[model samples]
Target: MKAASKKTAGTIALNDRREICNVPEPSTTRLNKRMAELGMCSRREADDWIARGWVRVDGQVAPMGLQVAADARIDVDPKARGQQQEQVTILLNKPIGYVSGQAEDGYQPAVVLVEERNHWRGDASKTRFAPQQLRGLAPAGRLDIDSIGLLVLTQDGRIARQLIGEDSGMEKEYLVRVTYGDVAADVQSAFPRAQLMRLRHGLSLDNQPLKPAQVDWQNPEQLRFVLTEGKKRQIRRMCEQVGLKVVGLKRIRIGRVLLGNLPVGQWRYLAPQERF
Candidate 1:
């Protein structure tokens, strides 16, 4: 006797003649793309390999723009990974007069901060300056060419984002040495005893009381200024308005990072775990 038919499960099957696989498709993607997803080679390099017929999929030569299953046999030519692993980060106590990124008339790029002669034997080979690395490397933040202080240059993107981001909230501290002409005691009395002065009355005060400055006697004529923000020639400008002249300006710290005892014109590799 013939058996009775079962009720339909109500699922419609796709009926396309071009469909090749009975397997419900492994989320179709390209071989070159798959290689890139595996962190093997860049997508552009992967495409070039495919064009050269060097890329294989399940043992068949693949073409540029060919589509393949997400999981496919993939291999990259030996040089595709290139020399990116040797990326480095250098921290320099930048001296006056070196532009941070690109060289301009009469001045050198801060990158020269590490001339070949300065490269220690253990540092990466001359290939350290390879073009691919330079594309991602830059000074994470700036120190004006006229100023002297700790400047950071790095190949890492995360640190750069942190240092220059608007909400970075990093405190940069400076020690400014200033000298003042003899001012009548009345003028001095009108201003707070802070190393920075606020024009309290009948005065032009533009800055916000100069960031809550601290005053201390360095000598009868000289005062030491410590500040958190490095506005343009701010110490010099402030001193000029108060009958004083800035003789020296030096940055001592950025966030918890310090200038330490590092000598002028020298640099050190940032410790691998160091940030901010």
Candidate 2:
């Protein structure tokens, strides 16, 4: 038997079937949050577009703090909604040639080193750098192009903030090889069995002043230095000022984290319990 169509007060077209329905009172959810729930874009992106007057809800412009019914007509401008959502974090044992962030005149940024094959899948091997995890990942800290060491790229802002924030207590350790112009006899005597050296009163020819440093011999030619703050070309400059020319400089650790045997140009995860 064919059903009779009642007087249509309102209509909802679902799966190509037109059905008569009552028009319930309109309800609302915060526009920015609603946009994010739809997975269309980030909440911040929605807020920016709404302020630019580009988002429309129920066929009208959306204003900040304005709410709209969940089922209301909503449209994001063509140019507004960006590309597919993919967040990635790539830990790279950055080699000497690549810059840390933006491109320089001829050098490529390190982020490009992450290849599709490295994209992290749930599998152990694939989780190294996942395609889906690439969305908002960025370099949390920096490594000089001339320096080879551990570099971290991450989507976690809290981790990034903790590691590189100005007030961060994280320590960066380096292995430096130095060649001195004229070795001070006292320094050579102090250097041999010394686990620590203080350059306070200052090293002078009569007595040259050197900044205090915690230095330890890694080998006859190398010294390990641990510092909490990083300044531009700090180690190199410090070595030069002390009458020692730095022939090689490598960052071997950051906080309790070691660059380890990851190999040059390779990277791995800091174990779950690892914290800076």
Candidate 3:
């Protein structure tokens, strides 16, 4: 007839079938890690919430470094959510001579341009500028001090992770002006098609093979590159390998966000409706 089942300490026995199945215990993960996995906040933010008693697990206040089951209920205090909402993401038209991150060798960082006076007048975002927003504000991605274009700075951890996380595959588009040896104008016609194909794939950097990229001629002297990974001065270095020298490089887009007529050295708040 039907198999009769019985439960033992760590196994389930089917009497008629003479079969047994092991019952494994639920796996546990660190409290902060579990919270981050759920997309609630970053691990650092989760730890801060736990320390502030803003996080609860299974209806009890979660302690720092606590281990929790995957199914455990996580409740975040309203204060934590309010603080997250206050965080801001700014898009800047970074100009040359400014480093993307920290000030180095007497060069100012791009974030210094995010002051009230530099706010884009054409910006339609309703968010007002506040000095407090500058605290913890850092670049989400790097744009070399010598190159200029769209650069992102933010106080929101989520945006930082979204833009530069290890697994992130966001596309960054650039317009690169290049010249070949003695050919500065109309170099595209002189450049071989096979070398252009090599730029699109089969290129290696830092001893590692680079992911395939979208590389094409934007004009006679300019090449348009769309890459999902950002290495240090990647466009310049990539041009060098193909017997081309980069004269100018500008990042035009990141994900779906564009540099779009935002004046150089000016900044604007990322609108709520815009993503990426």
Candidate 4:
């Protein structure tokens, strides 16, 4: 069962095409948080809907951030569903030198590469390019300006929450090329196995324990890492702890979706049938 279905009762919002499932039991938590827990929307989006009187509890408009009972029947206005339908998700093979969120110091943001001309010809999605698709679109998860690979940008709050929310469980896989300073020393031999163990389970960042990650050597100079959480330049920091320097990094997949041959600096739509 989904975590949100623990105690709450849910009904599809009127006129909604997709079932409004996953509404969480209120259980004394803030209303915005409850909506996010249910996978309804991100907390920020929930707050916006509540403020607009687009959210309801037991068929009545909900008050902003109100705390309520576990069994409250939460509902969203049809306008919310309409708004959701307009959202789009884009996948990009980000090349180095472009920031994920915004431009800085003369460097452009990766979204600038999401132009009509950059749409991959092999994309199976028949959705035509529209300037409106760029409106309100933001990076759901960030990739370092120095790294390259799959970078997700979207207007959908649900997709954003699914990938980067506080409680998200989606996995991101990356291939990294590393250097350990000594030209003749192999990283696997020079970097102690115990440190690898720490990379898998014992490491912490910002005074909090990092979620366990899958880290293993892909080749003599490359490592494969799969992580459930992202911190600022996390992999690079983790490598530093073990005396390894990350020379190159490329995200290969997010959840079940692979970046697969999407040329750098190009993008494609996230197909309707794909979930992550």
Q: Which stretches of candidate 2 lie over 4 Å from their true place?
A: 1-89, 116-128, 182-213
lDDT of each: 0.60, 0.64, 0.91, 0.88
> Model 2: how far is 273 from its true place, Å?
3.5
Tens digits of per-residue lDDT, candidate 3, 1-276, equal 123333452243234234344545559999988877777887888989999999999999988999998789999999999999999999999999999999999999888898999999999999999999999899999998889899999888788878888889999999999999999999999999999999999999999999999999999999999999999988889889989998899999999999999999999999999998
In the range 134-249, model 1's lDDT, one tens digit per residue, is 45457866676776877888765445545665445566666655544544333334334643434112223364444545444445444545544445566566667766656566
The clash numbers for all candidates, in the given order, read 0, 20, 0, 1
Off by over 4 Å in 1: 1-86, 119-135, 182-230
lDDT, residue 173, model 3: 98
Q: Model 4, 1-276: lDDT tens per residue? A: 675664333433332434355455435878888888888987888988999999989888898769867677999999998988777899999999999987899999999999999999999998898999999889989999999999999988888988998888899999998888774347777777888898898888899899999999998778899999999999999988877889999999999999998999899999999988
Q: Top model by lDDT, which number?
A: 3
Q: Give the TM-score of candidate 3.
A: 0.89
Local lDDT at 196 for model 4: 83
Tell how far residue 231 is off in model 3, in angstroms.
Answer: 1.4
Candidate 3 minimal-lDDT segment of 10 residues: 1-10
- Local error of candidate 1 at 239, Å? 3.3
* Count of clashes in candidate 2: 20
Candidate 3 pairs with clashing backbones: none
